[model samples]
Target: MGNFIMGKGSRPFVMENQMLMRHGLITGATGTGKTVTLKVLAENLSEQGIQVFLADVKGDLSSLAEPLENNPDIQARLETLGVKDFVPRSYPVTLWDVYGEKGIPVRTSIAEMGPLLLSRLLGLNDTQSGIMDIAFRVADEQGWLLLDLDDLKAMLGYLSENAATFRSQYGNIAPASVGAILRSILSLEEQDGDLLIGEPALHVADLLQKPGEEGMIHILQSQKLYLKPALYSTLLLWMLSELYEELPEVGNIDKPKIVFVFDEAHLLFDDMSKALTDKIEQIIRLIRSKGVGIFFVTQSPMDIPESVLGQLGNKIQHALRAYTPKELKDVRAIAQTFRESEGLDVAEAITSLQTGQAVVSPLDPDGTPMPADIAMIYPPKSKIGTLAEERYGELMRQSPFLFKYEQRVNRESAYEMLSTRAEQLAREQEAEALRVQLEKEAKEKAKKEAKNSPRSNREGITERFTKNIAGTVGREVGRTLIRGILGSFKR
Candidate 1:
């Protein structure tokens, strides 16, 4: 799929497969063939047997699985480029979705997402983020695995209820902050964040699968996901982080083991916290050693940070509209990035470049910068637009995870564990109350018996006294009578 596109002033233009691991960028205004270039690169990389993972924000890349439709313009371009052996064909593809509507559900554990990313996903404030971190810490200490949004929610509730105890060890977890975090999480759930956080989490190995000569193309269906920009960006970043953390170091390989294309790449940085932005920059700078290449697709180069832009060795810049002064300035800055060529006025060329044309600068065989050239991007052999919903379903049915990821696995995580603990605690409190009540009743009955026994003892004492007095009086009278008779006789 990666052959010579055209002769650039008698020099053949090509994207060397070996230097692809160095990473790349694709920038252009809307309707300027950015999606087409992305498709071309994806198809070619897959042809080279390199696994490809890309987020299809507009659902445009889904058609890569279908044969390119015949178009007169495509034929003319092929003829103009003097390509005789060009055969339109489809590549192997697998579809995935967080929502489970368009493809196999792709999910990850809440712990895998971690508090930092989750905070970004939920758009939590600093205090709320701090509370979230505490919640995760509490969950970890309690041996509770957070596998879903509900798990995090339950953990937050648990922490709020036991805030006093947690404060001693973890720090103050304000109920207001906890509530804010919970509300944020609830908001995310309303946005279908529940579908993204779960068990049987996506295995990184699944993405590295190359079934045949052509690597498998895993396209994340992101039409609905794109609505939540934070979630969308965080999802891709987490995937990148996972790949970086999990994959063994394979420094400077012949080619990339996997290629990740982040479309609408600006969303990953917009409103992104400084710490997170630095983290992302660091990942982009270092993950190349893992034999993974990241391509950022966006509207303009300004959307990318300077630190990130410096690392992108290969640049494919599509057309830009310079209606405003700032846009023209941006165009000039973009033009200056290319290596100087004799008569190639990059600024002018950028505004006038036709659709399917781009200013490309890929690395050479010796890891040297190839002089930038204006080249007509080779048309993708696969379909250029979205596949029908029925067609999309048909392809999904053939995926390896047809039934595996379809049914969500709700393993006992923080949610169920905390819920069970709460129920158990309530039962224990109830039992304790019952025991106390029983003990109180026993004490009251014993007191009543003791009080009655005292009265009975008094009654017995009085009766015995009366009896003794009567007996003594009678005996004394008899004795007295006897004594009186004796005394009278004696007298």
Candidate 2:
């Protein structure tokens, strides 16, 4: 085989028809054609009946929604590759924002985000994660809704306030544990808490849909999200988990519901706890059943866990600089990931691959691995780099879901209800204080009147008061008055 210019010469590989929904990976160092390769694959996938989901880490992918202006190089490449009817067209693209301010609101409620995924985003270590877990469990039991970070924070606060009470039920929530866990969640809020928590979160079903006419691409911008790696990973994994929960068992299909591209995958694995890592492993393993495929785009395969790397059946490795021993080791390891080819020195080929080129070793439609081929990656139909600024905003303005998510909807969730409850409690306390003040004033006035007047007047007052209430009822009025001072008040 020669250059299988997707759509040109009937694609030498079976993927030309449709297999990307099964999933794929596009990885390379910065400045390489990772983004371009992604665009090309996205365009091709859109060409098929399937839809695509792209994480536009740098925001450049916004150009994908626009039509590609014909350039000499792209035209020449397409002609030489024998591409048939290659019309530069735009795919169905949706702009999604976790914060819901920048793009269409893509949010998942905290109730939907269970404890396992939430713990890692909090950056909780083993013990701290356990405490966080307990907080979630306690929230569920107390009829509390953990809809957002504030809800979780409230859960933590309730635990600390009633630590003595919860110790028996939840097993020892220490002051130190409380401090560590609260600090962790607070830090996350400062970083991504506001963005992660709230109403109108992402719906996994939206991602699964083929948004437009057949073969249109869907891209997600991730430039603003680089700072919150923990939140980013959690959200990404949460998406996968949601897919698993919603998608029924499809056994096997020629294509997937949607192909997920996880660019900058190293951010997800860097310094993550063992528990977090294991949870990621579980999601990646099980999500396949839901017909959702995941691809990790990183500098080297080492950035991904061995468990996850093992699960990724499709591999597209680009050039690597083998200037250092570790670099060379990484190159060799990447070579081992593919089916060994006779004419190819994959290890050597990796270091020598030209720009816009990679070792494509997709699992053939038959489920058997194809031979590693040094294929010329298809040129992206979109502009080489990000679309101009204001491009995404324009897209959002025209989006159908604009009115649905553009205007922020503040539902009466925990935050609003808690604020209301606090006000009610304050009013109740104020009324009780006023009643006590009035009673004190009456008692003092009664004593003064007794001292000024004759002793017969004080005796007459007591006799009159007793005579006034003597036949009222069998109820003990004195015990009721005493109960007000010593017993708990519900008002």
Candidate 3:
């Protein structure tokens, strides 16, 4: 694998592409260049012909499609960093969106999303989540494909109707719990979930495209999606899970087959259930063997769980303010995680660093952490801001997948099948009611005719006496059989 230039330190700091598959992190304060570092990493990885997938949470990352503007400040920084052969150019890029506004629509079936992530998206409590799991199980057993929101709603309704049947098999699902889950799902729909769950779902292969030496950069336009933090984070995690499941194990290749950069990574961990948290941690640890790299971009290292933090081999930390005692404690705690380097006070350097500069700790050839150094991260070769709306639209139109996922397709799924079942049941009930009414009318007419006949007095009395005697004998025999059957068994 070719060496990856991270930025400039006392010397040119390089990252081995092979080690990138090991995972990494980039953390800093709000305005201290976390996004820039993220861009830099993406640019370098793409240049090495490794596919990159990242979310443009703030919409600025879309500028990766256009070259950066040359300026005096940029030239001066390049000189200070002792860079040569630096050119302002753009890389191969693709845009996608869940809302189908900024880019091609990206969707996934509710069945593929499964219950675990959906429960997290809905913020369901333990019991409510259990009820959702039961819904999925019932759907699986019945071979229903839950492709959209209505499909899930249909499944929940069916479960409620047959709660007694499923209670022993799955669990006791309370009607109130099912109602709460349905209400939560409706609330999710109100948050634009309809655009997110549908047909022509996102294929994992689309994310791993490389047409030239520079790998394709897939940017998820998430400006509007960021409004619903849970939705955005849950979607990202779902993709990650898909990557882990779809990609085969390559076992320590020269470079990662794909590099995934998770911007605003803290949203993935916030209020996560223990079960999900454990699964995420396991994925992070094992996905490296699949030749996939995961870089989490967040504000502070503390924002990441300790188990996950241990997995990130490359660390690029930007500035952090230590104006308060608590802030200082956090800063010191973050600084201690780095390997000790002589002549570099990690804590002091952390708070003193300026924009576009970070404390770098990339892994060496032997897969060991290099001594941490305060380095100036290079500016991205791509545009520093987003592209014009027309340009963005044009680029979206040129995408090969534009035609594939453009039109919405609503095939037969759980929702339609359940609706048909309901209609059929309703018609059957109506027919049965009509038949009962006709039988009642016929019996009344026959009884009136018998009373009007001359033989009513003679035959009616004799028939009544015979029927009473037969009914009495039948009841005695039935009672004796029931008693014998009951007495035969000991409780």
Candidate 4:
């Protein structure tokens, strides 16, 4: 019960106004109960009719898919908070795992994914990332579609093999750039990138769907995927890009299509190149119109990119380890972010927070940062943590997603065409080698026969002799030229 006091009756705190769900962040050290806090907010928001997209990196939050249980502690919290008639409700939810272990297969076409995001996934440096961008551009121009990793590899191979040809049309591609980018792709492939490259890329609609009267919650299984930080980050950013691209502008709706919570968010921004960082900033800046909100979950407020950090209007700070000077400094920084109530000692409160308690600072209407309050977060009504593996699978098989991405499709994508062409070219080379081999064998056989039987050359030489009967005059010219030169010298 150390951190589990933020309940309904503990304090008066506004969780979030659905209208201001532009973007937000939930950050604290491990054991500070970020997951529980996220659950409380998501459940409350979903109850208020907002869709939620939760990336459960630890895979412990799948219980959101199940109905909430009745518990005395929950009832006590609600009663203490002066609230009555609290009912446990389950939100509509779909489980998503990039590895396809838990949910319907979510895939994105390589063309739609494009190179900008893939570059980050591959961890390409500036030069290599540029080369990748060029590859995507070239694919677009040639009417080639990239549907998977193989297609991308083939496109790169084609470009490298035909550098001169591509140079004439799309400018020069240096061998060095191509090599670096290819190496990055290989590194990605070694991580079993096949999971990332396939049809049925996650649909924004799937994330947004809320059947019947219940609000939808999307739970992404991110434990294994998080091991590849680059891929993990890129996958999230790509989904955001897809949402931005796919969803129409809805201005300020009552609720967003989905609330995207990026736990362990520092991985997304840390070690990213400037171009990739800039694109993230752009997407974060522009995605609000698409009716989605992004919440960064990390250890410290500093984990967020400043560009992105500046945009998060809501802040929920739990306890921090303020032993070191640097950490204490972070605590001070966290305190200053909120509008202070005189004598509230926000920094002191941050260091003193228990497991379930947080120094809450949600934005009010008019975009103004509200004063910090020591607020008690409510407990989730659902069973927390993993459901049975068999149960997860059963849900997917019987899911109502009939027309969604079940089909393993083969389009005129880069993979098929390049593989086909490679096979064809290999066959052509083999055929040519066979023809040469046959001709060489014939020549050897003819020579062997000629040596063994003199008649074999006699008939052939006589025929050659008959054709060259006029060839004797051609040799006489050489003799005439020498004689003329000698005669001139004597004269």
Candidate 5:
């Protein structure tokens, strides 16, 4: 495994391949070479045959598929850094988009996302979140699949209608909570969050590059997605969770199987619940054993929660402008995160860092955090910005996943199953109602016919009068016979 040079400090600052899975952070102000550092790491990892996944939030990272052309400024920097073996090259790239407009549509089923993450995505309160959990459990117990937004909506509707039925088993499912969840679903749909969930769901295995082939850099087109911060962060986290769950425990491998770069990462923690934050912290702490590495890229170190920030072994800080007292205080705190280097004031160094310069602390060869160094970031071997439209289209057409995930599959999931069950129940109720109505009508008809029958009433009166006359005559004859019989008996 070859070590990729990040830049020259006092000596060449190299990122060891074995330490890539230790996780890292890249923080800087806007336009302070965070993107460049990200590109460099991704390109180098790909060259070493490790798959990479990163979000192209600003549409800048998509050009990894295009080779960098000769630029005078880049050449001068390369000379200044005394780079011996730098080549302009492009890496294998697969483009994905939730919107399906920019690239291959990436999707995941609601079941795969589960309740906790889905609740976070929906911004649900504790009550509503509990209802969501019940909804999933109900779906699962009833053998219903929660595949898409429609499935979830159907499930929630059923829960609302049958809250009393489920209350005994799954606890109270407040109608208001269900209503809140429904409204949140509607709001998400309005934001096109529906596009993120469905069939032909993304397989975590597909994110890995095929053996004996160059590592593929999967870039999610996130410009539109970033607008909906909750969705954007949740989608990324869902992907990470999948990786952590699916990949086998390959503890401390030579290199990571995949490296994930999370851009605009502050959005992930902002307004996040403590429970979820702890979950994320745990994931970051333990996911290295799964041969996966995560790098968080953001504007400032303060944007990250301290719990998560501490998990990153490799640290890279680009410039932060500290004019205000608060900004200066933040810069100092950011500096404190790194191990102090001799003769370098990190706080002062951070504020005055040039556009391509950053203070880096990559892990040492024996898996130790190195002291901070002020180093110039190397420009990407690939093109630095968005690819040309035609080239991008061609690449999209050539993607193997395009055909696999292009069309959505909507099989009989919760929506269809619940809807069918409801229809059947309605039919049965209708049939029972009709039977009751028919029986009542038959009884009423019989009563009315009996009341209107004159022939029957006349027959009844004639029979009674005839019987009465016969009875009186027969009684006199019988009395005489009985008296004679009694005299005979006495004698």
Candidate 6:
């Protein structure tokens, strides 16, 4: 394992590879070098064969695939920090997109996402969320696979239509709640969120680099995704949850199996339900044992909940603005989060520190928080901005997993199954209706024939009496002749 130098203070600032799994936080105002710090950490981790996953909201982090070009300012900073042997190079990068426009498409099935995360993404109220849970339970019991937006939509439609049938087993499912959830689904679809739920789901193992190779940096292209705050946060949270569930426990490993960098970290907690907030807090607390480190990159520490904020062992505080009274108070609170140094007034340094300089507090080798130091951050070895369009295209073509997730797959799931059932029911109903119509037509034809036939007239009473008298006389005459003949033969 290799320890990377962060930058220079009174002494060299370094991040121990073994302590990377302890988790960390990087906070500052916009343009205060948060992105640069992210890039630097990614480069070092990749060099150490540690996989990294981060979102590129501004479309700039794609430059990790391109080598750094000549920059005088970077060279000067390296010399000032007494840094030697800094090579400009690129790392392995896999690009992903939810919309499938910029890179390989990434998707997860609706069932795999489960009801809770889907509810969060849809911004559902408690009643609506309960309906969603019932919908999922019904789908599971019926052996229907919820694989995409269409599947979920069909499930909701079925629930609405047959609420009474399901109510007995799953409880009362209100039509209004179902409608609200459907409307929420529609709203999500309008935002191109439909693309995020489907087949060919992303496997976390695919995010890891192969053995005896440099670690791969999986960058999610979030330029448009970030526009939808709820979706962006929920997607990242789902990926994190998946990692925690999938990875094996390796307590206190020399290095993390993977490092997750969540940018725009505040959006994750915005309007989050208390239950969800507690779940997230628990994941952060226990995920370290799974050899996964999560670093949250945001504008301010105050953006994070106090419970989560306390779990970060490494602290990187970039310069923050404090022009107003509220801002001053926030800065002070942010300053107090760090381990105090001997001479540095942490709060004053927070507002006065230049860009690319931050107060760093990484965990010591003994797993304890080290005192904060005002230090300069090292520049990334890769390019500082977005990758060129031509290079971006070339990299996409070269990606090994391109064909795997490029095409969307829609297997037989809840949507198709429900549709088939509905169609069959419709056909049977139509057949029964046709049978009934045919029977009625036959009866009407018989009645009409009887009314128009020659037997429509009635017989006269005299003719009916004469025919009855003639028939009786003929029978008596024949019986008398036969009796006389039999008596003569006997004599």
Q: What lDDT is reached at residue 258 by model 6?
A: 92
Model 1 is weakest, by summed lDDT over 10 consecutive residues, at 1-10
Candidate 5 TM-score, true structure as reference: 0.91
Q: Write the per-residue lDDT of candidate 1 for residues 358-404, one digit (tens) a residue.
A: 88788887767777778887778999788988988899899887777
Tens-digit lDDT track for model 3 on 1-491?
67878798976678899999888989999999988888888889888899999999888998988999978888999898888988999888889999888899999889889899999999999999998898888788888889999999999999998999988888787999989998998899999988888888899888887777779999999999988998899999999999999988998689998999999899889999999999999999999998899999998999999999999999999999889999999999999999989999999999999998999999998989989899998878888977899887888898998999998899999999999988887777666655655665575567657666787656767886775586567556655654554444322
lDDT of each: 0.83, 0.70, 0.88, 0.74, 0.87, 0.87
Candidate topping TM-score: 3
Give lDDT: candidate 6, residue 130: 88
When summed lDDT is taken over every stretch of 10 residues in candidate 6, the lowest stretch is 482-491
lDDT of 2 by residue, 55-130 (tens): 7788778787777887998888877776666677666677877765457866667778877677777766777777
Model 6: per-residue Cα lDDT at residue 146? 94
* Stretches > 4 Å off in candidate 2: 1-22, 99-102, 211-216, 416-491
Greater-TM-score candidate between 3 and 5: 3
Mind giving the per-residue lDDT tens digits that candidate 4 earns over 1-491?
A: 00122343134666454534558878878998898888877777676666787787887787777766777876776665676655665566777777777776566767777777777777777767766877888888867888887788889888898889778766778888888877877887888677777776666776776775556777777878888887787778788888888989988765666778888889888788787788888888888888788888899989877778888888888888889998889889878888887668999999988877788777665567767887767777777667777877876776666347656566678767777887787777666655655665575566556555766456676665663564455445545654565454444
Selected candidate, larger lDDT, 1 vs 5: 5
Where in model 1 is the C-alpha error above 4 Å? 1-10, 454-491
Give the TM-score ranking, best first: 3, 5, 6, 1, 2, 4
